[model samples]
Target: MKIVIFGGTGFVGLNLAEVLLARGHEVTLHDRSPLPPAAQRSLADYRERLKVVQGDITDAQGIDALMAQGCDAIVLGAAVTAGDDLERASPARVLEINVMAQIPILLAAIRHGVRRVINLSSASAYGAAGQRHRILDEETPCDPVSFYAISKFTSERSVARHAELFGGDFLSVRLSAVFGPWERPGSVRDTPSLQFQILAAFARGEPALLPAPGIKDWTYAPDVAEAVALLIEAERPRDRLYNISSGVAWSALQWGEAFAALHPGLECRLVSPGEKTVIKLHGGDRAPLSVRRMADEFGWRARRRAPCSGRS
Candidate 1:
């Protein structure tokens, strides 16, 4: 398969690209930044197996050219993630990257007869369900609380519309906190409260900060990439949206304790939830999404363990 991936240098994208490349698929990565030396070296090892193109999604001509390369499928993973302070953020740019950019690229994909698209949506779109104990499925009502969520939700809707009009298969994976290797340093990695605390402490050789006692699921990036691969290869396409996450839930304290156990030499401190700015995590109480739909239809499962689970 010839796969064209948007935002391929980032954490999730890089993991997905590696998976696809290993499976002998032709991979082309489109991104705004020049490939880092490490990424360039990795791709170089693949020779003709991989290609990286530097282009802006906002540029219609550039997107069109890439789409014209006869990609079998497109994966939209580019976006300005959450954690930006609204005061210094450009809502226009945010919307441009998340929502507006999809228009031209998707249209070009359709024009070029691309077969499928897997859009990376966010769980944040469900908003502060705050102990509502609601199970958020594909049909869950969207109450986006932040600009990032709003943009992602709008983009998913836009992609659905394009899929309907253009006669191409589109799948939206509403992802939870995706963590693993190749993590970039920015809002995408830091926005999650637990990760923010872990990364900060790891940087300083201190303990991670824990959130208030609450349950949440964190999906590993490789598992997410595997789920995406199955979605791409499914024989019978189903709903346009699916929640990709670990069915199990863990409290913030559990995560910290687990991490401390893994690296015994690291000093661990559990901070009171009161010391942290409290933003309600959107999806915790919901019953685990039945992978039966994906399993029966496409044979997808959570293939990776949680970070602190101490399971390889």
Candidate 2:
């Protein structure tokens, strides 16, 4: 199969691309940014199966053209993972990319007769509901407070509605806090992963300062990629909305400590009351997302082999 991932240069996009390529599928990564050097090196072995294109996600014409080139499936991975700072600085741009830009791509996919469309949503879409509930499922009512959350929820509904109206094989998967390879600070993604920050701090010979345990149902990027691949390849998924998550909660401090043991100069510590750290948590830790739907339907589950155990 031939697949194209919007925002393919981003963290999860790159992971998904590698997974698809490994499965013997041709992939095109269309994004506003060029492929990072590290990702380029990692994917060098699959050069024959992968193509990277630099273009704006909002360009309807470009989307149509890409699909016209014989795309079997399309993954909507472009998004502005905004926080309070970015929301305040550029709210419209956030909506433009995360919500409004999705319609054009979906329309193009439909027109080109793409077999499947997978929308990569976020667990942040749960927003306040995530805080209120200990477990979030597809049926949970969402009360998104942040612009990023609002946009994600809106995008999910938009994709679902499009599928309903056009009878297209389109679905949305709400992903939990994703952290793994190819994750780096970028213009659109202001919130860097705790793991990234910890490794970075150690590299600078400074302790990884944390405001709290930074606990949540963090999912690995590779697992997420595999689950999404399942969705795209599934003959017909039973539900329009699903949650892709680790199904267990863990702390950043635990992960940091495990890493510190391997590195001589590394340190991970809690911040003192008056001390400030550049590391920013995405939001107050929320409850874990339930992966029952994903697991039951596709027989997929997150790999919990990371040292970050399910300890308070």
Candidate 3:
């Protein structure tokens, strides 16, 4: 399979690219950043097997040229992630990069006969999860709370509309808290509240700030990459949207304990913030998508291995 990945130079992109390459699939990575030194060294052997296109997604001409290379599928992994000051920034620029930029790329792919498209969506689109509603599934109502979530949700709708109009294949994977190796510096690899507290304590050798109590269903990067590969290879794709997550919930305290277990002798005072109730989504008793569905349709399974190091 010849797969083109937008923003393939980042954490998730690199992991997915590695998985596809190992399976003997031709891979093309489109990104504006120069290939990181680590990735360049790691993928050196397969330099010819992989193509890197340096251009912004806003550049329609460049995207058209990339699509002209005859990609079998395109994975839209590019996005402006959260933590930005959305209020001060221009909303038009935000939409241009996150929503409008996809138009030309998807159009070009369709024009060039691309078979399928996989869009990366965020679990945050379901809004803050709380005690009453623990799990958010594909059918759940979207209550996006942040600009990033809004952009991702809008992009998913746009992709679906394009698929409906063109009679093409598309799937949006609503991903939960994802973390593993190769994460970029200061990237949101951990839950935001947890990350801030952990970094302050561990990296800066300062006391930890307790996170407001909440449960998150975290997914490992490798597991997510494998699931994506299987979704691409599925003979008959069923759901247009699937939750890519571990399906197990862990509290912030549990995460902190896990981290402390990993690195003993790391003594730091802990400060607990008063408990605050937040919306909890997608951590219910039943699996959002049954194992049978994945097995019968896409041949995917939850990886039951131990959590990756540095995670709780």
Candidate 4:
């Protein structure tokens, strides 16, 4: 299989590229930014299977030109993720990157007769609906609240519409709270998981004063990449939309306690929901996503986890 990822140089994209390459698929990473030195080194073993190219998904002409090279499938991994200051920032860019960007890419996929396409949608599309429902599934109605969530939902609709018009096979997978290796604070996203903050705090010898210890399902990035790879390789997808998550809602206290047990020295402190902290977090109720669909269709489930990494 020959696969091309639009935002392939980013954290999740890079991981997906590696996973696909491991599965014996040729991968091309198309991104505006150059591949990092660490990534280049990390994937050196599969260098022949991987091609790192430079292109911006927002540029329609560039996308057309790149799609000309041809690929077995395309994965739209390009999006500007929301950060801590999401409400007050990049309102236009959020819509532009997440919503508008998919138009040209899907059209080109149709033009080139690409076999399959996967849009890496976000679980945030559940939005406030999570507060209402216990578990989010493909059947759940999207109640997008944040700008990022709205864009993702809009893009999913756009992809489905394009697939219908072009007679294409496309799948949109809503990813959960993913955090793991090759993760970093970047221009696009910050480390949002309580597990990550606890690990980093312990490493820095700082108090893990996490904001709002509410329940949320956290998926490891590696597991996410693998699930996506399988979806990309699916000969006949059972559904157009699926949720890739841990499938279990874990409270902050539960995760923090696990972290403490792993590293007994550092304490996990939880600030009250209304209180202020270095990083603002929500202590609100959460809806865990069901992975039953993915499991039932592809025999897929996340085996790895959002593990605490600080060790002696």
Candidate 5:
């Protein structure tokens, strides 16, 4: 399969590109920024299977030229993925990148005779209303708390509407708390994984500390990438939105313990439960993502056997 991933240089995109390559799919990474040095070295082994197109996704002509290359599928992974930061920062830019920018891309996919197009939406689509449900399924109502959430939800709707109009094959997958390889720290996204922080500390020759521990669905990046690959290759999807997650709620301390055990010398310390932490677990609600539909429909499940990756 020839798959094109927009924002392919980003964390999730990079890992997805690798997973796709591993699965014998031809992967193309389209991004404005070139691959960072670390990603370049990490993906060096798969150079033959992967291709990078450095261009502006917001430009219509650029997108047309990209789609002209002919692809089996296209993954829209480009977006500003922060809730509070987007709310505080440029909210309009959030819609511009996440919502408005997707229209042309979707159209281009339709025009290119692409078989399938996957929009990488987020669990943020669940928003603050996600707090009410202990488990969020694809059917949950999205109460968008921030523009970022609104943009993701709106993009999903826009894609659905486009499919309705053009009869194009398109799907959106909602990913939750993804932490793993190729993920880097930047102004675009602020929430680093507990596993990521610990790993970074180990790299810096310091102990990893979990300030405040809580429970949330922390999905590994490679696993999530595999799930996306599964959907991209699916001939027909029963649902428009699917959750790609570990389908488990793990606490910071629990992760800290296992993480430390995995890396013998890496020490991880967890602070008191009441202290501030990376993921703010609201009232200790383990709002795990419901992957039953994905399993039942696609036979896709996240199998985590290695240490989760992330950046600081």
Candidate 6:
């Protein structure tokens, strides 16, 4: 299969690209940024099957031209994950990138007769509903509170509406907090995963201090890549929307301790009662997402981090 991934230079994109490439699929990575040097090195073994194109996702003609070249499937992963400050400063840009930019790509897919389209969504779309429900599924009602959340939820709807009107095989997967290989600081996203922050602390020889336990069902990126690959290759998925996650909740501090175990001299612990913390957490603890649908549909479940379990 031939696949094109927009936002392909980003964290999730790179992971998905690697998965597709390893599985012997031809892949084209289209993004505004050039491929990172580290990722380039990691993917060197599959260089013959991988192609990287630099372009703006908002450019409709550019996308159409690429699709014209031929594409079997496309993954829409371009998004501006905004925080409070970015949302206040550039609200329109966030919506434009995260929401509006997807239309032309979907249209191009339809125009080129692409077989499948997957929009990479986020658990942030759950918003306040995440805290209210003990286990979120596709049917959970959302009350997105932030601009990023609203845009993601809106994007999912846009993809579904396009599919319905055009009779296209397009679906969106809402991924939980994803962290793993190929994660790096980038321009579009405001929040890096807690695992990334903890690793950064380890690199600096500083203790990882927690703002809070920061518990949630944080899925590994590689696992996420595999789940998405299943969707991209499946003959026909029954559902229009699905949630992809580890299916178990764990705290950031626990992850930090797990990392500390690997690093001899490092420390991972919570802050003093009133001490200040530099580490930024997305929000308070939320429930883990249920992966029963994914398991039932594709026999797919995220790899576990440890023995602890809940909500799988």
Taking the tens digit of each residue's C-alpha lDDT, what string does model 2 give over 160-256?
9999999889999998888888888778988887878877887788899988888888778888999999998888899998999898898888898
Please provide, for model 3 over 1-312, each residue's C-alpha lDDT reduced to its tens digit, 9 standing for 90 to 100: 999999889777898998999888899999887678889898888788898888888899989987897888889988766554442355565567778899998889789999889998877666644223646666667766556768888999999999999877987887766666556533322224443355446776544445333345656777789888888777668878877877676554455556666777553233445533221222222223223445456657668333344432
Where is model 2 poorest over a 10-residue stretch in terms of lDDT? 303-312
Candidate 2 vs candidate 5, TM-score winner: 2
What order do you get sorting by TM-score, best first? 2, 6, 4, 5, 1, 3
The alpha-carbon RMSD values of the candidates against the true structure, listed in the order shown, are 3.2, 2.3, 4.6, 2.6, 3.0, 2.7
Instruction: Show where candidate 3 strays beyond 4 Å.
Output: 84-90, 128-132, 185-208, 268-296, 304-312
225-281 in candidate 6: lDDT tens per residue? 999999999998999898999999888788788778766899888888877767899
In model 5, the Cα lDDT at residue 286 comes to 37
Better of 4 and 5 by TM-score: 4
lDDT of 5 by residue, 1-312 (tens): 999999999989988988898889888999888988988887788888889889987998999988998999999999887646545778888889898999999898888899998999988888876779878998888787668778999999999999999999988999887777777767666656666676676788877666656567878888899899889988789888898888888766576676678667877777555655343322224378899999999888888633342232
Instruction: Please give the TM-score that candidate 1 achieves against the real structure.
Output: 0.86
Pairs that clash in candidate 5: 180-309
Write model 4 residue lDDT over 135-245, tens digit each, in one string.
899999989887888889998999999888888999899998776766765676654666666667777886677666656787878889989988888789878998999
lDDT of each: 0.72, 0.88, 0.69, 0.81, 0.81, 0.88
Query: What 10-residue stretch in candidate 1 is worst by lDDT?
Result: 277-286
Q: Give the Å error, residue 139, model 1.
A: 1.8
